[model samples]
Target: MATLQIDADNFQPTITNNATVIVDFWAPWCAPCRGFAPTFEAAAEKNPGIVFAKVNTEEQQEIATAFNIRSIPTLMIFRDQIVIYSEAGALVPAAFDQLIEQAMALDMDQVRLEIAGQQASS
Candidate 1:
Protein backbone atom coordinates (compact mmCIF):
# COMPACT_ATOMS: atom_id res chain seq x y z
CA MET A 1 0.00 0.00 0.00
CA ALA A 2 1.00 3.59 -0.52
CA THR A 3 1.91 5.89 2.35
CA LEU A 4 -0.85 7.94 3.94
CA GLN A 5 -0.34 11.66 4.34
CA ILE A 6 -0.99 12.23 8.03
CA ASP A 7 -2.06 15.58 9.40
CA ALA A 8 -3.83 17.02 12.43
CA ASP A 9 -7.12 16.02 10.83
CA ASN A 10 -6.34 12.30 10.76
CA PHE A 11 -3.42 11.78 13.12
CA GLN A 12 -5.39 10.60 16.14
CA PRO A 13 -7.65 8.13 14.42
CA THR A 14 -4.92 6.81 12.14
CA ILE A 15 -2.59 6.00 14.99
CA THR A 16 -5.32 4.60 17.20
CA ASN A 17 -6.41 2.10 14.59
CA ASN A 18 -5.25 -1.47 15.23
CA ALA A 19 -2.37 -1.69 12.76
CA THR A 20 1.36 -1.41 12.60
CA VAL A 21 1.86 2.20 11.57
CA ILE A 22 5.16 3.66 10.48
CA VAL A 23 5.00 7.44 10.57
CA ASP A 24 7.65 9.52 8.85
CA PHE A 25 7.95 13.05 10.18
CA TRP A 26 9.40 15.31 7.51
CA ALA A 27 9.37 18.69 5.82
CA PRO A 28 9.66 19.56 2.14
CA TRP A 29 12.57 21.89 2.75
CA CYS A 30 14.76 19.27 4.32
CA ALA A 31 17.15 17.62 1.92
CA PRO A 32 17.30 14.34 3.81
CA CYS A 33 13.51 14.25 3.98
CA ARG A 34 13.32 14.43 0.19
CA GLY A 35 16.06 11.89 -0.17
CA PHE A 36 14.39 9.49 2.21
CA ALA A 37 10.94 9.80 0.65
CA PRO A 38 11.47 7.14 -1.99
CA THR A 39 12.99 4.73 0.49
CA PHE A 40 9.95 5.11 2.71
CA GLU A 41 7.58 4.57 -0.18
CA ALA A 42 9.52 1.56 -1.40
CA ALA A 43 9.34 0.11 2.06
CA ALA A 44 5.58 0.70 2.03
CA GLU A 45 5.28 -1.12 -1.25
CA LYS A 46 7.25 -4.03 0.16
CA ASN A 47 5.05 -4.28 3.24
CA PRO A 48 1.42 -4.33 2.27
CA GLY A 49 0.03 -5.09 5.69
CA ILE A 50 1.73 -2.15 7.41
CA VAL A 51 0.34 1.37 7.41
CA PHE A 52 3.07 3.68 6.16
CA ALA A 53 2.24 7.31 6.83
CA LYS A 54 3.89 10.69 6.59
CA VAL A 55 3.36 13.94 8.45
CA ASN A 56 4.76 17.04 6.74
CA THR A 57 6.08 19.15 9.56
CA GLU A 58 5.70 22.38 7.68
CA GLU A 59 2.10 21.68 6.85
CA GLN A 60 1.16 20.05 10.14
CA GLN A 61 3.09 21.74 12.90
CA GLU A 62 0.54 20.71 15.51
CA ILE A 63 1.05 17.04 14.85
CA ALA A 64 4.81 17.47 14.65
CA THR A 65 4.94 19.33 17.97
CA ALA A 66 2.82 16.72 19.66
CA PHE A 67 5.49 14.15 18.88
CA ASN A 68 8.26 16.51 19.98
CA ILE A 69 9.99 16.00 16.67
CA ARG A 70 13.28 17.85 16.98
CA SER A 71 14.59 16.79 13.60
CA ILE A 72 13.28 16.09 10.17
CA PRO A 73 13.03 12.54 8.79
CA THR A 74 12.15 11.05 12.15
CA LEU A 75 10.63 7.59 11.97
CA MET A 76 8.17 6.32 14.52
CA ILE A 77 6.55 2.92 14.65
CA PHE A 78 3.28 2.36 16.47
CA ARG A 79 1.23 -0.73 17.19
CA ASP A 80 -2.03 -1.09 19.08
CA GLN A 81 -2.05 2.69 19.76
CA ILE A 82 1.32 2.60 21.45
CA VAL A 83 4.64 3.95 20.22
CA ILE A 84 7.11 1.08 19.94
CA TYR A 85 10.05 2.83 18.33
CA SER A 86 11.04 6.44 17.65
CA GLU A 87 14.24 7.78 16.22
CA ALA A 88 15.64 10.62 14.12
CA GLY A 89 17.58 10.28 10.86
CA ALA A 90 16.81 8.18 7.84
CA LEU A 91 16.95 4.42 8.14
CA VAL A 92 18.57 2.40 5.40
CA PRO A 93 16.47 -0.29 3.75
CA ALA A 94 17.97 -3.10 5.79
CA ALA A 95 17.44 -1.25 9.08
CA PHE A 96 13.87 -0.40 8.19
CA ASP A 97 13.17 -4.02 7.34
CA GLN A 98 14.67 -5.14 10.63
CA LEU A 99 12.47 -2.68 12.48
CA ILE A 100 9.37 -4.13 10.83
CA GLU A 101 10.42 -7.64 11.80
CA GLN A 102 11.10 -6.62 15.39
CA ALA A 103 7.85 -4.67 15.80
CA MET A 104 5.88 -7.58 14.38
CA ALA A 105 7.39 -9.90 16.97
CA LEU A 106 6.47 -7.85 20.03
CA ASP A 107 4.09 -9.17 22.67
CA MET A 108 1.53 -6.40 22.74
CA ASP A 109 0.05 -7.57 26.02
CA GLN A 110 3.42 -7.07 27.63
CA VAL A 111 3.75 -3.73 25.93
CA ARG A 112 0.37 -2.66 27.30
CA LEU A 113 1.24 -3.85 30.76
CA GLU A 114 4.47 -1.89 30.64
CA ILE A 115 2.56 1.17 29.61
CA ALA A 116 0.02 0.68 32.38
CA GLY A 117 2.71 0.07 34.94
CA GLN A 118 4.51 3.25 33.95
CA GLN A 119 1.26 5.19 34.10
CA ALA A 120 0.41 3.82 37.53
CA SER A 121 3.88 4.50 38.88
CA SER A 122 3.61 8.11 37.86
Candidate 2:
Protein backbone atom coordinates (compact mmCIF):
# COMPACT_ATOMS: atom_id res chain seq x y z
CA MET A 1 0.00 0.00 0.00
CA ALA A 2 2.38 2.59 -1.24
CA THR A 3 1.28 6.19 -0.91
CA LEU A 4 0.10 7.74 -4.16
CA GLN A 5 2.45 10.32 -5.63
CA ILE A 6 0.76 13.68 -6.20
CA ASP A 7 1.97 16.44 -8.51
CA ALA A 8 0.85 19.91 -9.50
CA ASP A 9 -1.19 18.61 -12.42
CA ASN A 10 -3.15 16.00 -10.50
CA PHE A 11 -3.26 17.22 -6.90
CA GLN A 12 -6.87 18.42 -7.08
CA PRO A 13 -8.19 15.18 -8.51
CA THR A 14 -6.27 13.25 -5.89
CA ILE A 15 -7.94 15.14 -3.05
CA THR A 16 -11.32 15.94 -4.67
CA ASN A 17 -13.11 12.61 -4.14
CA ASN A 18 -14.11 13.31 -0.52
CA ALA A 19 -11.76 10.65 0.71
CA THR A 20 -9.23 10.89 3.51
CA VAL A 21 -5.97 11.72 1.80
CA ILE A 22 -2.64 12.47 3.43
CA VAL A 23 -0.31 14.41 1.22
CA ASP A 24 3.36 14.57 2.13
CA PHE A 25 5.18 17.53 0.73
CA TRP A 26 8.86 16.72 0.47
CA ALA A 27 12.09 17.25 -1.38
CA PRO A 28 14.81 14.76 -2.22
CA TRP A 29 17.61 16.75 -0.75
CA CYS A 30 16.00 17.07 2.64
CA ALA A 31 17.47 14.57 5.04
CA PRO A 32 14.49 14.66 7.36
CA CYS A 33 12.12 14.13 4.47
CA ARG A 34 14.05 11.11 3.32
CA GLY A 35 14.13 9.70 6.82
CA PHE A 36 10.35 10.00 7.15
CA ALA A 37 9.56 8.34 3.84
CA PRO A 38 9.73 4.82 5.22
CA THR A 39 7.58 5.75 8.18
CA PHE A 40 5.00 7.27 5.87
CA GLU A 41 5.06 4.20 3.65
CA ALA A 42 4.56 1.93 6.61
CA ALA A 43 1.63 4.03 7.79
CA ALA A 44 0.11 3.85 4.35
CA GLU A 45 0.47 0.09 4.45
CA LYS A 46 -1.21 -0.04 7.82
CA ASN A 47 -4.06 2.23 6.73
CA PRO A 48 -5.32 0.92 3.44
CA GLY A 49 -8.53 2.90 3.75
CA ILE A 50 -6.70 6.22 3.57
CA VAL A 51 -5.25 7.73 0.44
CA PHE A 52 -1.65 8.53 1.25
CA ALA A 53 0.16 10.63 -1.29
CA LYS A 54 3.43 12.46 -1.81
CA VAL A 55 4.06 15.79 -3.46
CA ASN A 56 7.67 16.42 -4.46
CA THR A 57 8.03 20.09 -3.74
CA GLU A 58 11.02 20.53 -6.01
CA GLU A 59 9.12 19.17 -8.93
CA GLN A 60 5.81 20.78 -8.07
CA GLN A 61 6.53 24.38 -7.15
CA GLU A 62 3.09 25.59 -8.20
CA ILE A 63 1.38 23.01 -6.05
CA ALA A 64 3.64 23.92 -3.13
CA THR A 65 2.74 27.59 -3.55
CA ALA A 66 -0.96 26.80 -3.77
CA PHE A 67 -0.74 24.97 -0.46
CA ASN A 68 1.57 27.60 1.04
CA ILE A 69 4.16 24.96 1.77
CA ARG A 70 7.09 26.72 3.41
CA SER A 71 8.90 23.75 4.81
CA ILE A 72 10.00 20.32 3.78
CA PRO A 73 8.13 17.21 4.83
CA THR A 74 4.83 18.95 5.40
CA LEU A 75 1.86 16.66 5.90
CA MET A 76 -1.63 17.69 4.99
CA ILE A 77 -4.64 15.49 5.63
CA PHE A 78 -7.67 16.15 3.51
CA ARG A 79 -11.15 14.83 4.21
CA ASP A 80 -14.27 15.54 2.20
CA GLN A 81 -12.13 17.53 -0.19
CA ILE A 82 -11.14 19.91 2.58
CA VAL A 83 -7.97 20.18 4.59
CA ILE A 84 -8.54 18.71 8.02
CA TYR A 85 -5.00 18.64 9.40
CA SER A 86 -1.78 20.24 8.25
CA GLU A 87 1.67 20.48 9.74
CA ALA A 88 5.22 21.25 8.76
CA GLY A 89 8.34 19.16 9.47
CA ALA A 90 8.94 15.45 9.63
CA LEU A 91 6.95 13.55 12.21
CA VAL A 92 7.90 10.50 14.20
CA PRO A 93 5.73 7.40 13.84
CA ALA A 94 3.83 8.17 17.02
CA ALA A 95 3.18 11.75 15.98
CA PHE A 96 2.12 10.54 12.57
CA ASP A 97 -0.34 8.14 14.14
CA GLN A 98 -1.76 10.96 16.22
CA LEU A 99 -2.10 13.08 13.13
CA ILE A 100 -4.07 10.35 11.40
CA GLU A 101 -6.33 10.02 14.41
CA GLN A 102 -6.93 13.74 14.44
CA ALA A 103 -7.74 13.67 10.76
CA MET A 104 -10.20 10.85 11.31
CA ALA A 105 -11.87 12.77 14.11
CA LEU A 106 -12.65 15.80 12.01
CA ASP A 107 -16.34 16.35 11.34
CA MET A 108 -16.50 17.65 7.84
CA ASP A 109 -20.30 17.86 7.74
CA GLN A 110 -20.37 20.02 10.83
CA VAL A 111 -17.55 22.14 9.48
CA ARG A 112 -19.51 22.70 6.31
CA LEU A 113 -22.62 23.52 8.26
CA GLU A 114 -20.71 26.01 10.35
CA ILE A 115 -19.38 27.68 7.25
CA ALA A 116 -22.86 27.88 5.83
CA GLY A 117 -24.19 29.28 9.07
CA GLN A 118 -21.49 31.88 9.11
CA GLN A 119 -22.31 32.89 5.58
CA ALA A 120 -26.00 33.19 6.37
CA SER A 121 -25.29 35.27 9.43
CA SER A 122 -23.02 37.55 7.45
Candidate 3:
Protein backbone atom coordinates (compact mmCIF):
# COMPACT_ATOMS: atom_id res chain seq x y z
CA MET A 1 0.00 0.00 0.00
CA ALA A 2 2.75 2.40 -0.85
CA THR A 3 1.62 5.72 -2.21
CA LEU A 4 1.51 5.76 -5.95
CA GLN A 5 3.11 8.58 -7.92
CA ILE A 6 0.36 9.72 -10.21
CA ASP A 7 0.29 11.91 -13.28
CA ALA A 8 -2.29 12.57 -15.99
CA ASP A 9 -1.52 9.30 -17.71
CA ASN A 10 -2.21 7.05 -14.74
CA PHE A 11 -4.74 9.06 -12.84
CA GLN A 12 -7.99 7.81 -14.34
CA PRO A 13 -7.30 4.08 -14.22
CA THR A 14 -5.74 4.25 -10.79
CA ILE A 15 -8.62 6.11 -9.20
CA THR A 16 -11.57 4.45 -10.89
CA ASN A 17 -10.70 0.95 -9.74
CA ASN A 18 -10.27 1.78 -6.09
CA ALA A 19 -13.27 2.09 -3.80
CA THR A 20 -11.52 4.89 -1.93
CA VAL A 21 -8.75 7.03 -3.26
CA ILE A 22 -6.90 9.79 -1.46
CA VAL A 23 -4.98 12.16 -3.66
CA ASP A 24 -2.43 14.59 -2.42
CA PHE A 25 -1.77 17.58 -4.60
CA TRP A 26 1.76 18.67 -3.85
CA ALA A 27 4.88 20.36 -5.11
CA PRO A 28 8.46 19.58 -4.18
CA TRP A 29 9.31 23.13 -3.15
CA CYS A 30 6.39 23.55 -0.78
CA ALA A 31 7.24 23.19 2.89
CA PRO A 32 3.81 22.06 4.01
CA CYS A 33 3.67 19.48 1.24
CA ARG A 34 6.97 18.06 2.40
CA GLY A 35 5.69 17.93 5.95
CA PHE A 36 2.52 16.15 4.89
CA ALA A 37 4.27 13.55 2.78
CA PRO A 38 5.18 11.30 5.66
CA THR A 39 1.68 11.41 7.06
CA PHE A 40 0.28 10.52 3.66
CA GLU A 41 2.72 7.68 3.23
CA ALA A 42 2.06 6.34 6.69
CA ALA A 43 -1.66 6.39 6.09
CA ALA A 44 -1.24 4.47 2.88
CA GLU A 45 0.65 1.79 4.70
CA LYS A 46 -1.96 1.68 7.41
CA ASN A 47 -4.91 1.54 5.02
CA PRO A 48 -4.00 -1.06 2.48
CA GLY A 49 -7.43 -1.15 0.90
CA ILE A 50 -7.43 2.51 -0.04
CA VAL A 51 -5.47 3.91 -2.92
CA PHE A 52 -3.19 6.74 -1.87
CA ALA A 53 -1.74 8.70 -4.73
CA LYS A 54 0.32 11.82 -5.18
CA VAL A 55 0.14 14.29 -8.00
CA ASN A 56 3.12 16.60 -8.20
CA THR A 57 1.82 20.03 -9.13
CA GLU A 58 5.25 21.10 -10.23
CA GLU A 59 5.66 18.25 -12.68
CA GLN A 60 2.04 17.64 -13.55
CA GLN A 61 0.60 21.03 -14.35
CA GLU A 62 -2.13 19.58 -16.56
CA ILE A 63 -3.42 17.37 -13.76
CA ALA A 64 -3.34 20.30 -11.37
CA THR A 65 -5.26 22.47 -13.83
CA ALA A 66 -7.85 19.75 -14.45
CA PHE A 67 -8.50 19.46 -10.74
CA ASN A 68 -8.44 23.28 -10.34
CA ILE A 69 -5.96 23.04 -7.56
CA ARG A 70 -5.32 26.63 -6.49
CA SER A 71 -3.23 25.78 -3.48
CA ILE A 72 -0.26 23.61 -2.76
CA PRO A 73 -0.94 20.54 -0.57
CA THR A 74 -4.59 20.29 -1.47
CA LEU A 75 -6.10 16.97 -0.39
CA MET A 76 -8.91 15.20 -2.18
CA ILE A 77 -10.78 12.05 -1.29
CA PHE A 78 -12.68 10.06 -3.87
CA ARG A 79 -15.16 7.31 -3.22
CA ASP A 80 -17.17 5.23 -5.65
CA GLN A 81 -15.88 7.18 -8.65
CA ILE A 82 -16.90 10.53 -7.18
CA VAL A 83 -15.09 13.17 -5.19
CA ILE A 84 -16.37 12.97 -1.62
CA TYR A 85 -14.07 15.43 0.14
CA SER A 86 -11.57 18.07 -0.79
CA GLU A 87 -9.73 20.73 1.16
CA ALA A 88 -6.65 22.88 1.19
CA GLY A 89 -3.69 22.80 3.63
CA ALA A 90 -1.98 20.10 5.60
CA LEU A 91 -4.01 17.73 7.77
CA VAL A 92 -2.76 16.62 11.15
CA PRO A 93 -2.79 12.85 11.63
CA ALA A 94 -5.92 13.07 13.73
CA ALA A 95 -7.73 15.02 11.03
CA PHE A 96 -6.50 12.64 8.39
CA ASP A 97 -7.78 9.72 10.44
CA GLN A 98 -11.13 11.42 10.77
CA LEU A 99 -11.24 11.89 7.02
CA ILE A 100 -10.55 8.21 6.48
CA GLU A 101 -13.20 7.30 8.96
CA GLN A 102 -15.68 9.57 7.23
CA ALA A 103 -14.89 8.03 3.90
CA MET A 104 -15.35 4.60 5.39
CA ALA A 105 -18.71 5.57 6.83
CA LEU A 106 -20.09 6.86 3.54
CA ASP A 107 -23.10 5.18 2.04
CA MET A 108 -22.21 5.25 -1.64
CA ASP A 109 -25.71 4.20 -2.68
CA GLN A 110 -27.17 7.27 -1.03
CA VAL A 111 -24.41 9.41 -2.43
CA ARG A 112 -25.07 8.20 -5.96
CA LEU A 113 -28.79 8.74 -5.57
CA GLU A 114 -28.08 12.28 -4.42
CA ILE A 115 -25.79 12.81 -7.39
CA ALA A 116 -28.49 11.54 -9.74
CA GLY A 117 -30.98 13.90 -8.18
CA GLN A 118 -28.60 16.80 -8.56
CA GLN A 119 -27.92 15.95 -12.17
CA ALA A 120 -31.62 15.68 -12.91
CA SER A 121 -32.28 19.02 -11.25
CA SER A 122 -29.44 20.59 -13.15
Candidate maximizing TM-score: 3
Clashing residue pairs in candidate 1 are none
> Model 3, residue 48: what's the lDDT?
93
**For model 3, which pairs clash?**
none
- Rank list by lDDT: 3, 1, 2
User: What does the lDDT read for residue 12 in candidate 3?
Assistant: 96
State the lDDT of candidate 3 residue by residue for 17-97, as single tens digits.
888899999999999999999999999999999999999999999999998999989999999879999899999998898
CA error at residue 18 for candidate 3, angstroms: 1.4
Candidate 1 — worst ten consecutive residues by lDDT sum? Answer: 10-19
Q: What TM-score goes with each of the models?
A: 0.94, 0.90, 0.97
What would the per-residue lDDT of candidate 1 be over residues 49-105, giving only the tens digit for each residue? 999999999999988888999998999999988899999999788888888899999
Q: Candidate 2: which stretches are off by over 4 Å?
A: 118-122
| Per-residue alpha-carbon lDDT of candidate 2 for residues 2-121, written as tens digits (9 for 90 to 100) | 888888667888888748989999999999999999999989999999999999999999999998999888998888887767889888899899888877887788988987898999
- Please tell me which model should have the higher TM-score, number 1 or number 2: 1
Clashes of each: 0, 0, 0
lDDT of each: 0.91, 0.88, 0.93
Which consecutive 10 residues in model 2 have the weakest lDDT in total?
A: 9-18
Name the 10 consecutive residues with the lowest summed lDDT in model 3: 13-22
**lDDT of residue 3 for candidate 3:** 92
What would you estimate as the lDDT of candidate 3? 0.93
